[model samples]
Target: MAHNALPRPSSLPGIEDLRRGYTPSTHEARQSIEERSKQLRLEQERIDAELDRHIAEMQRLSLRRRDVVRELDLNHALLAPVHRLFPELLSEVFIHAVQDPFNVQKTDFAVRVLCGVCTTWRAAARATPLLWTFIDLSYITSLEDPLLRLQLQLSGQLPLTVTAKVQDQAMQLLLVAFFDGMSDEDASRVVEITVEDDGVVLSQLRSRHLATLRVADVNIWDTCTQGELGFLTSAPTLHKLTIGVQYECEDDDAALAFPVPVIPDLPCLTHLILAIENEFPVSAFLPAISQLAPVLRVLKMSSFEVSAWEETKPTVTCEMHVLHSLELQHYTHRFLTFITAPALHAVTLIGDDAQLGKEDPTESLLDLLTRSRPPLRSFALHDPMQGSASALSGCIDLMEGLQRLNIEDNERGVTSSPRLAAVLQRLVCDENTPPMLPELRSLSVQCRGDKSPCVHSDVAAPLSQVRLSRKDPRVCAGRAVAALE
Candidate 1:
């Protein structure tokens, strides 16, 4: 063959020429390619459809977010007009909102929100009585004139039991407002009036409506307490009165300054607790108290007043039908003569030191318990053994119905306490915690002795005396019995 010559191509085919010249090899191969092309085209159409669906879902979520924002705007929008139209509604809103005490704890947001609505809201807030129902002068420094009007309205028909505690300011205005609400008619409804203020502001005025009065922790450190008690006599219905007085600038000869409010003849007093700070001339009061508190069930005293007279003969002329529980702490001899609670159920004596006093009072106290109205169930006397177990042992049968009993002396140990325990051993559980008490289900004993087992071993049949500590000889005996069986 001669040397072959080839023609040189001028350029590559254009996109249009390539498209036109494209061909399939066979019918089957052409069908396979056409099917693949149709699949690719359909796949691209499906991708576009999915994109459109995702865009619709995104639009829906955005519209929902806008709706929530709009609702929030509407809800917050209603409050402003409500406060303006009905100004009293501001205080009412506070009354309803303050139902949750936590709302008023740190910041009274609900209160301020209502008050800040407008000037009319503020005026209505000042006038509304319910808003000032509980006067927490704990935070108030300045007084608005309407405070008195609000207090009177809030008191309504009920007599006042005003319990106020103020330290910083002269709470005289607050007291005036409170007392103004009480008419002579409101005296019967008053249950108690307790005021704890500094600087002896109580000396400024007197009240007549109170039935029960307790004034404690007044910061007149040098103020005499005895005369101050007289100030409480103004209350006509007052039966239970407590005064905590301080004696300052003590001139032994100087007479004490106090209010002399005439204490009414209290015929209905059932309980009285008197705490005199310094040496008070209560000898004058002894006859009066006895005559007045005729039906008195409980009488409590402190160490200072009644220490003088060893035997204060308290006449039990009135019927003590409802006297059951008696508690005496730091009592002196004069207080003891009045200890005739004929109907006493339980007696707890704390801080009675005969060692310091002139007389040994163990016998008199025991006599009081034995002569009580009913059988005593639980008797607790501090350092009881310091007196005599024999005296206390006499009080066991005071109450046949008394099932629960607790006797504990932190000072006494195994040797000293066992005497009392022996007397109370009737309550002990020998077999399955003495089932004698069908009414008494549970019993506990905390007093322990060193030589004695921290807990006594359970009684097993006659053979096994000690089953708890394995070292007990009863274990060997039990094993022997088993072998024989």
Candidate 2:
């Protein structure tokens, strides 16, 4: 072969370069293998470093995620079981769990969260049309039309729930919207409607399944005007009716008159609470009660009026049946004039002495107990007016099945700053007229403030807290008496 033009058969281009000047020997080959091994090691080290950094970053991210979770505000959640999942039931539970009225945003968020849980839950949540039932008309500037629109919208979906706070004009319009939204076909879909205001406009809301209706802060002055109200023909499904009547009238008789009360026959009614004041006319309710309510099991009647005489007859006559609990708050002399409940099982009387008249409130209370259906199982007498006493014998005569008796403001006339220690010894403390209460199981006496302001300032001022007797041997059977000095 010519010098540069010819190449040896064993000398290939790439193979000859690998071999270089020396022949392919074991040691040389070993060196090449070692170099390749070193390169691989370097690459592995770089990869290891990158992996360590990546791991550190992942750990940091995890820590940040945990921190975020800790800072999150948690709402009350009923940890339901995963097995039997019912989204609508969960939503109902959440509705009641939301005790904070202003947390409507949270409520909406909860509904969304539940819907996002699973497909089955989402379907269930959607199925319950009443799930989104809430009325918040706190801002009453453009109330009537806006509220009416909202009411109509809610009426279209499922049953409606009315919850809002508005004053005079807005309240009237809200009432109108409520009545107007109902269809004549059936009222069963309307679940619950609650109103918290002192004013009310009589509207005919005859629902089929409307279970509960409550109205708070009822003012006598806000009743139906001469031509404003006639008759409420549709509110027959109301199971509970709570009315707060603020007394501003000097004449009790005229104040209590209802413009027109044409109540429908309602047998499902069970509970009635009326806080009438300033001479609210109970007679006006007669037209409604005579035809409307029949089965009342719990009746709570109170009046802020001192001369609310018109309600006495009805308060007594209307309340004489199947009552299990009775709470008489601020019992004016007008109620004591001729009040009676033959079926009352539990009686609670709460008021200051100033609200009472010359008659001993205890005697009047005992008189009712005698007329009650059976022995009052629970009796609470709170803070009677000054010089409070009922011939202990006479008061005990009222109860036939007395199980609990709670007496508050037991301090008599000792705050007059007189040295009647002898009288206190003979007629008060030492004069234990033997326990006449046979079946009395629980007795609690709250010796807090006195009826007279003088006594309260001087004597009752020191008593801030009193303890209840628990460890007594007769906890269940013995007459429980709580005495505070």
Error of 2 at 54 (Å): 39
lDDT of 1 by residue, 133-223 (tens): 4434443443454443455465465434445565545565665454554455554445565555433455543546454432222223344
TM-score of each: 0.49, 0.55
RMSD of each: 19.3, 19.1
Q: Give the candidate number with the greatest lDDT.
A: 2
Q: Runs in model 2 with CA error above 4 Å?
A: 1-131, 137-159, 168-171, 182-187, 196-200, 203-221, 225-232, 246-263, 281-294, 308-319, 332-340, 353-359, 370-373, 385-388, 410-435, 449-485
Count of backbone collisions within predicted model 1:
11
The lDDT of model 2 is 0.49
Worst 10 residues of 2 by lDDT: 421-430
Model 2 residue 319 CA deviation (Å) reads: 7.5
